[model samples]
Target: MRMIFIGPPGSGKGTQAQLLSQRLGLLHFATGDILRDAVAKDTPEGQRAKPFMTGGQLVPDIIVNDIVNARLRSKNRPVKFIMDGYPRTLAQANSFDAVLKEQGLDLDAVVFLNVGDEEIVRRNGARWTCINPECKATYNTLTRPPLTPGRCDLCQHLLYQREDDDPATIRRRLQYFHEQAAGILDHYARQGRLIEVPGRGDIEAIYASIVKALGK
Candidate 1:
């Protein structure tokens, strides 16, 4: 059940990864969550990543690759897992392949959730996040609105849209994603491990499609 879920921002790849991991009892290896955990613990890698994260810049591939490779070599390394957001670039994918080879692991599939740019902008435009750093719960006005408008359901913190969620920023982000994704997707497709799934429907329906594509 080792797989990777790759998609553009606002494609619901994180949500789908969580669901699929739970359903298959596989570890959900989400890079963002892992980096957040590192920052919370104030680990060495976190120290190096914090500046870039706070400045809204992408962390260098060397740092990201180091963290991922170390996890793969950990004593408690997962035997089965779903990678949600690692290998974001072709370079990262190449680095990941080396680590997987070293760990005697092989990816079964690389699922690409295909969503239109217009749809992504609409979805992300409606997204809001809790101001409370500890409870940065996210809500989408159209998909999963908060119980109280402009407030977080768990902590009651005021919700605000992230700057990156603005339509113009989202389009820029999408452009960058497509540029990087073309190479990564083609890399997997060449290996006969790529699974393309439509990402513009009900969450469950999209999940079902992925499952069927995986034949699981």
Candidate 2:
């Protein structure tokens, strides 16, 4: 039941992936989490990724590809996984297929969470995050504000709006996502494996649609 989850930021696809993974007993491979773990572990690849990360620059595809491939080939890898926040570009998607091929694995589905740009911007504008490095809890200004404004409810750490969550940056990111997503979507669509799910309204409702789409 290998699957890839694709969506713009604030689409709630990550939450859906977690739910689906738990229900199906599939490994949840979130690329950001994996990369952050590697960095925290200070592995060789992590050391290489640190400079780019500290500078707020995107890690090169080669490094990301290597990390993903290593994880997929690890003995601890589950027979099935739901990949999130990966294959951001057409090149990465193509390289990913090669990695799976080498491992005798194939993707069963590519789930695209479809959220409109306006909604994405609106949702992101309400986003906030913990400023403390040790406590990175996220909150939304509109939907899920912390008990105290600008404070993490759990750790009492100061909370802030991520620069990327600004309306301008959100628009920029959405544009980039759509541009890259087209080719990636076409790649899976041609394979008859792409599943588009409406990503609006209630979270459970969105997830229900995903389950139906996957016929699971």
Local accuracy by lDDT, each model: 0.91, 0.89
lDDT of candidate 2 over 1-216, digit per residue (tens): 999999987788889999999999888988888888899999888888888888989888888898898887889866699989888888889889998999899789999999999999888888899998988999998889899998999999998878988889889988988998899999999999999998978978898899999998
What is the alpha-carbon RMSD of candidate 2 to the true structure?
4.6
In candidate 1, list every pair of residues with a backbone clash. Answer: none
Highest-TM-score candidate: 2
- Please provide, for model 1 over 14-117, each residue's C-alpha lDDT reduced to its tens digit, 9 standing for 90 to 100: 89999999999999999998887888899898888999998989999988998899889999999899998889999999999999999999999999999999
- Tell me the spans in candidate 2 whose CA falls farther than 4 Å from its real position: 126-165
Counted clashes in each candidate structure: 0, 0
Positional deviation of residue 90's Cα in model 1 after best superposition, in angstroms:
0.9
**C-alpha-based local distance difference test score of model 2:** 0.89
Best by lDDT: 1
